[model samples]
Target: MQTCALAEELAADNDFILYAASLHPFARADDQELSEKERYEMIMQELQIIGRRFISQGLHVHVGMPDGETAIKVCNLIQAFLPIFLSLSCSSPFYEGKDTGLLSYRTKLFEVLPLAGLFEYMENWNHFVDQIEDLRKYGIIGGIRDLWWDTRPNPQFGTVEIRVCDLPVKFTSILALVALIQSTAAWLVEDVEGSSALSPYLLKANKWQAARHGLEGRFVDPTAILGDHPMQFRLAAMILKSRVSPYASKLGCDSYLEHLDSIISGGTGADHMCRIYQNTGDFHQVVRAIQKEFWQ
Candidate 1:
C-alpha cells in the first residue's frame, strides 16, 4: 500500500495521476512511447502496425520453487487455472476510447506478439531448457524473457511466474489474486501426482472464453467424467476455492483468500468499468469513476 501511495504522490507532484486499468482507454495512434532499451525498440519495430496497441499492463506473480524441475511441474499443472486468474482480473474492456466487446482486450493484444500466449507443454526441466537454447541458437529470441508465455519457469529466480492476469483496479483485489496464486502453487507442489496435464487446445479455448466473457464464460473440464459438460467459469472458480482453502490457511493468507468471494460477488474490475460506462455513456466519466474507486 505504501508503494502505491508513494507512486500516486509522485505522479500528483508532476500534475499527473495514475490510471490502473490494463489498457489506456484514451490512447491515440501517435502515443507509441518507446523505451531506451534495444530489446523494447526491436519489439516495437516488429510489432509495427500494432505498436501503440501493444502497450498494456498485467500482474505477474512469481512463486518460488525448489528447482527448475519443480517450476516446470507447477507451470504445467497450473495451466488449467490460468483462465480463472484472467477472469478475475479482467480490466481492459475499453481500448482507444471505444468499448472493445471483450472483457480483457489486453490479453488479446499481448497474444499478437510472436512468442506470446500459452506456451507449449514441457515434459521436464531439460525439455524447457532445450527449447530456450534452440530459440536462442536460431536467433528467434535473445533470452528466455522473449518467450512471453502466460506461465513460465524463471530459472534465474527459481520461480514460476504467472503472467496472465490484468492489473486489477483495486489493491485488495491484487492481494486476493496473489494469495490465490501462491496457495494454488503450494497445493500443486503437494498434490501434483493427482493432477494431469491438460491438452493445449483445451487450455487455449478456455483462455479465449475467459478473455471474451470474463466470469460468464463456459469452461470444459476433461478430467471430470459426468461433469465434463461445460459450466460457467465463475462456478468453476468457486469449486476451486475448497481445494485451495487448506493451503491458503497454511500460508496465513485466509483473509486475502476471503477477498476472492467479494470479487466474485461484486464482479471484476472490468465489470465495474463496463457498468460505469453503461450508466454514464461517457468514457471520461468511466475513467473518473475508476480513479475514484481505486483510491478508496
Candidate 2:
C-alpha cells in the first residue's frame, strides 16, 4: 500500500505500523514472521542479517500547518513533550534479544539527520522564510528542505512532519501519536507567538531523560530549571489534557492511554524486551516473537 494510505488508515484509529521505503532494499514486502527456531534454521535475520525482518517500519505523521510561525510554535511546544510521547510510544528495545539500552533504537537511527532536536526559536513567520532564504543565500544548507527537527515544516503539504516514533506492531498507536500531534497543532494555532520560553539546556535535558529512562523517569518540565517543578508538571498535563484529549478521544485512543499505563506499570519498550530476552534465554526467539506479533 501507498505510505499515504497507510498513514491515513492509521490516523483513523490512532495506530501505526512499520513503513519501509523503496529506498531500503532490506525492507520486507509482506514477508511473514518466522518462529524463533525456524528463523534460526533458515538463517533468516532482520535488517542486519541474511534476511530482513519487519522491524524497519517508521511512524511519520504529517500535519498541514499554514506557515512557519505556527510550525515554530508547535515544534517548540512539542519538543518538550517529545520525550514523554516517545516514552509512551516506544516499542522496539531489542533487535535480537540483546538489551539495546535504547527504548526506540529505530528512532535513534532516524534522528541522525542534520536537523534533529529542538530548533532555534524563529521569532516571526517572516523570519522563517528569511532564514531559509539566507541559508540558501549563504549556502549554509539547502532551502526549506529538511531542517529535520523532531518536527519540521513541510511546505509542500503545508504541514509539519513529526519524525521521531518507532513503527508500532499495530497501526493504532501511530494514529494516536498523530492525533496527539494534530490536537497539539490546533492548540498552538491559537497562540501565534508562544506562551513562555524555556532555556535550551532544559529542553535538551528532557530529551536525555526520554532517551535514557523512557517512561520510568519523573519527566522534568522542559520550561523549568532542573529539579521538581510541580507547576511545570501541572501545566504540561493541562496542555496535553486540553489540547490532545479532544482529538485523541475523537480518534478512539482511550486505549492509547491504557497502553501508556501498561508501559509505565511494566516497563518501557526497552525494559520489557530486555526482560523477555533474559527470561527466555534466547535472543533469536525474542526477535521471532516480536516479528510474529508485529508482522501479519
Candidate 3:
C-alpha cells in the first residue's frame, strides 16, 4: 500500500496519467479510450503481440527449490492448488462497465495468450529441459521465459514460480495468499507423497470454474478422485483447517492464514466490487471501491 501511494505520488509529480487496472473495466469492448497502442509500442518487438493484449496485473509467488529436478517436482505438486488460489484472489468480475458475471476474468483473459495454462508434467529436469528446448527448436518460443505456464521452474533462481493469481486488490489479501502459497509449497517439498496427482483435464476444469464463480464455484474433487465436485468453500475449509494450519504455524503466518477464512466468508475482492456495483448501480463507484481497497 505504501508502494502504491508512492507510485501515485510520483505519477502526480511527473504529470503523467496513470490508470491502475487489472484491466480497464471501462474500456473492455473498446480500445479507443485506452492506451493499448502506447503500451504495445513500449515493449519488445517480438513480445508486442502479447503486450498489446496484456493490460492486466498478476501476483507471482516464487518458492525456492534446490535444483531444476526439485523445481519440476514442486511445480507438478502445486498445480492442483492453483484454482484455489485463483478463487481466493478473484478481483476482475467487472469488465467494460458491466458485470462480466465471472470472477477473475483476468484468468481466462491471460490464458488466451500462448502457453499460458498448466505446464505439461515432466518426469525430471532432463524431460523439462527437453520440452522447453523443443519449443525453442521449433521457433515456437524464443526462450524459457516465453513459456508462460501457470507455474514454471525458474532455474536461475532455483525456485518454483506460481503465476496463476490475479493481482489482489487488498494488501491483506496479497499477504494472506502469499503466505498460503509459500506454506503449501514448502509442505509439498517436504512431503511430496501427500500431493494430489490430478490430471491436466481436471486441473483445467477447476481453473475454469474458479474463473467463472470465484469462491462460489466448486472445485473438482481430488480427494475423492471420482465424485460430484464439492463447493470450493467446503474444500477450502477442509484443507486450511486440516492440512495448512500446521504449515501456517511452522511459517509463523497463522494470523494471515486465518484472515483467509474471513475472506471466504465475506467475499473475494471481485466479490466486493460486484456488491458495490449492485447497491450503487454505478461502475465508477465500483472503481472507487477498488482503489480504496488497493490502498487500504
Candidate 4:
C-alpha cells in the first residue's frame, strides 16, 4: 500500500490515475479524447496494424532457480496451474461501462498478442534456446525477452516468471500468489514424476475456463485420482489445503496463503466489481470501490 501510494504521488505530475488492470468504462476506443499512440510505443511496424485498442495489466511472479535448465523444467511444470492463479486473481470484469460476462476480460484481450498466452511445451533448455534462436534468425524477435509466454524462463535472472495473472485488486492477493508460485516451484524441483505434466491442450482449456468463470467453472482434472473432474474452487482448495499452506508455513507466509480462502469462498476482484455494478448500475462506483479497497 505504501509503495502504491508513493508511485501515485510520484506520477501525480504526469496525470496518472494509478488504476489497476484494464481501463474503466468511461474510456472507450471510440472516444476522441483517448489517444492510443500516446500511451504505448509500437515495438514493431507489423504491430501497428493491430492498433492498441485493448489495455490490460497483469501480476508477474518470478520464482528463482539454481540454473537455466532448472528454470525451464520448473516453467513447464508450472503451466498447468497458471489458470488457477488467473482465476484467483481475476479483476477485470467490466469493459467500457458494461459487464463483459468474463471474469478476466483482460486475459482474453492480452492473448491477442502474437506471442502471448500459454507457451508451446518445450523439451528442455536446449530446445528453448534453439526455438528462440530460430525466431531471432527470422527477424521475428530480437532476443529471448521478446517471447512473451504465460510462463517463461528468465535466463538472466535464473527465475521462472509466471505471467498469467491479472493484477488483483487486493494487495494481499499478490503476496499469496507470489508465495504460491515460489512454493510450487520449490516443490516441482524435487524430482516429481512425468504424470504431473499435462498436455498443452488441457492446460489451454483450463485457462479459458478460468478467464470465463474465475473460480466458479469446472476444470478437467487430467491427473484426478478420483472419479470426475472438480470445480475450480475445489482444485484451488485442494492445492491451498494440501500443498500451499504447508509450503507457506515453511516459508513463514502462512497468513498470506490464508487470504486465498476468502477469495475462493466469496469472490475475486472481478466478482466484487460485478456486485458493485449490479447494485449501483454505475461503472464509476465500481472504479471507486476498487480504489477504496486499494487504500484499505
Evaluated with TM-score, which candidate comes out highest?
A: 1
Off by over 4 Å in 3: 12-21, 28-51, 194-197, 223-229
Q: What value of lDDT does candidate 4 attain over all alpha carbons?
A: 0.73
List model 2 lDDT by residue over 1-296, tens digit each. 36656665775586543332111222343454555695344334322432343344456778777766777777666666666666655666655334556666665554554455666676666767787888778866654554656766677787777766555443444444566666666755664347565567766666655655566544666544223562332234334655556655655654553343333455444564556677877755554555444422
RMSD of each: 1.7, 9.2, 3.5, 2.9
Q: Which of the predicted structures, 1 or 2, would earn the higher TM-score when compared with the native?
A: 1
Clash tally, candidates in order: 0, 17, 0, 1
Output the better candidate (1/3) by TM-score.
1
Candidate 4 backbone collisions, by pair: 25-97
Cα-lDDT of candidate 3: 0.74
Could you give candidate 1's per-residue lDDT for residues 1-296 as a string of tens digits? 89989998999999878888898777765766677998778877887877756778899999999987788888888888889889999999988888899999999999988888886778888999999999999999988788889999887888899999999998888899899999999988997553456787888898999999999998876455215778888887787776898999999998988889877888899999999888889888877788778855
- Each candidate's lDDT (Cα)? 0.85, 0.56, 0.74, 0.73
* Cα displacement (Å) at residue 112, model 4: 1.5
Ranking by lDDT: 1, 3, 4, 2
The candidate maximizing lDDT is 1
Instruction: Provide TM-scores for the models.
Output: 0.95, 0.67, 0.86, 0.88
Clashes of 1: 0
Cα shift from native, residue 104, model 1 (Å)? 0.6
